[model samples]
Target: MHLFELTCTAYFKNDLDFRRSFETISHFITYAMMRGGLDERHTKSGYKHYVFGGLLPLEADKVYKKGSTYRFILRSPDEEFLTALSTALRQNIDHPDFIVVETHLNRRKSFFITELYSATPVIVTSEGNLFWTMEKNGDIMQLQRQLHDNLEKKYQSFYGEEIKAPQNFIQMIEIKNRVPQNIEIHKEGKKIRFFGNKFRIVPNEDEMSQKLAFTALACGLGEKNSYGGGFCLAGGMR
Candidate 1:
């Protein structure tokens, strides 16, 4: 699978909280797809061919005001998807206030090792409630299982292929800088809020393990990835 990264430089049109950045960026992406000729059904489908990371170089506690420059990353396994998004961004970013200054697309190589660091909060939903990695009784093993199942489900939805869960593929998952935050998101014309935590994952050796690791990088780790949760970077070579 090929992974493409869209590095964007943008400025907010108004003062905004960092918590809302994910939703704002999510809307921007949808607008781009529509401008690129994708219909609403395709853009809003269950298949998430892309996942986004959080805004970079900003303090988690700081508010982003107008004219503040920031960068964010988008990842996808499909080159065509990235191309269409880049084209739309260059033409026009739908946000009335937010302006896209510059955009760049880079083909990224998947790390051979199976370690990753979460760039955004990894979210999981249980009984209709959002669960963060660090808040679930500090059970790392259970969290890894949830992440593994989520990845398999995503593969099936996106690729129409089911992958068997590799026994004990996730060797360790470490939660660092545990910060609890609530994000306000507008969905289906109504505002909603979700609470979650940000964390990291470390995996063990095996072909299936490597595949899962790469898939996480491309499609994100836990739930709500398209909404800017579970974004990760390669931890390093094993």
Candidate 2:
């Protein structure tokens, strides 16, 4: 599958907190999609052709400072979709709260091996409840399995074909430096809270493993990705 990455730098006129940044940016994306002529039905469908990482400060711990620039990354499997998004952003360049100062887009080639790291906390669900990766007795093995399964499902749903991975693909995942966090989000006028885990994951260095990692980056690794829950970067950090 093909993928295009868009890195955006937004400058805020007022202080912004990290907790609310994702939600606000997500709203902006939806608005952009609408403005770009994507109907609500297609945008709200089961498959999301795009996944986005969180807004990170250009300088550490400066996310809440006014005039500080923050960066967000968006990945999509469709070049036309990204082009529409870019046009929409340019149309709204003069927004009062924040302005899109710079945007960089790059088309990513296929990789045979890669590392995947969480850009935002990933949310996995278990038994109708939210599951964070680093919970007490949380079974990292199960987490990896579910992550792979979800990625495969999303890839198939979006691209109309199943992704091939090794039989023990989950076994190849190595979790490193996991940090658990609780987050609350307002969606569709409802306030929902859940715990998520942010961590670094290294996939085995093999062709099949690399394809799996690329799938994860294309489709996001866990649940609620369109709502800012499962965004990840191919490398360890931006």
Candidate 3:
């Protein structure tokens, strides 16, 4: 098992609103995965220890590729899930965000990125996390702006246009022992706020979205969706 410790850096207001918004983003991932016809499952240990999401038990001998564009080899998973994820990613209208079967942690950067896909349009990276289908190649940083706008709109829809997130809750991680702390989690109006900065918030729904992503991961569902950060999912999980 991996050892994780919370990095106390950022802050959130309260647990109520934090939980609400956090859950919202996670559900979107669940919807996308269901649209791909897959399920996720997981078991929880304490508040931080989650078993079997990205790291699962599967065969490693399987080999596959997508023309000269990509080569995929599985260390654990079989063929079906990879196929679904590949198809979903390659079929992107805006830059498609696909994932590799085996994910490696960049110890140097203290972050993780997927294995390479060939013939990739070589679009420059951005801050937000947006991209295009071969031709569009929009920057992710710009997408972050878009996500922020969409989130604000979403919040306004329910909380009124006057609803603005408090400055205290910044989407960033404070890593100590490779674990993040002070995560800003939200579910509806009630949010889960923290005082430390162990958690890093990538631009997106963040806490909630990651939960849903973890939800999909647990269910073994694969599809195209904007994903950020390592997270845990327990909703509708088995």
Q: What are the per-model numbers of colliding residue pairs?
A: 0, 0, 68
Better of 2 and 3 by TM-score: 2
The residue ranges of model 1 lying beyond 4 angstroms of the native Cα positions read: 40-44, 59-61, 128-139, 177-179, 188-191
User: What's the best-to-worst order under lDDT?
Assistant: 1, 2, 3
For model 1, the local distance difference test gives 0.75
Candidate closer to the true structure by lDDT (higher is better), 2 or 3: 2
What is the overall TM-score of model 1 with all chains considered together? 0.86
**Tens-digit lDDT track for model 1 on 1-238?**
5588989888878876786788988888777777778656345867576788877778656777687888888998778778777877767555765877788999977667657887877777654464644555566667777888887777677667777855755777666764665557987889886666666667777777777788888888777777887788886663
Residue 53 accuracy (lDDT) in model 2: 81
lDDT of 3 by residue, 1-238 (tens): 0112111111112222322332332343334345555444212221111112221111243222222122221111123444443343233222122222222211111122111111101111232443222124424344333434433443333224443443312243222223212224455767653321112233224344433222222221111112212232222212
* Per-model TM-score on C-alpha atoms: 0.86, 0.84, 0.23
RMSD of 2: 3.1
Query: What is the Å distance of residue 15 in model 3 from its true position?
Result: 25
Off by over 4 Å in 3: 1-28, 40-79, 89-180, 193-238
lDDT of each: 0.75, 0.70, 0.26
Candidate 3 global lDDT? 0.26
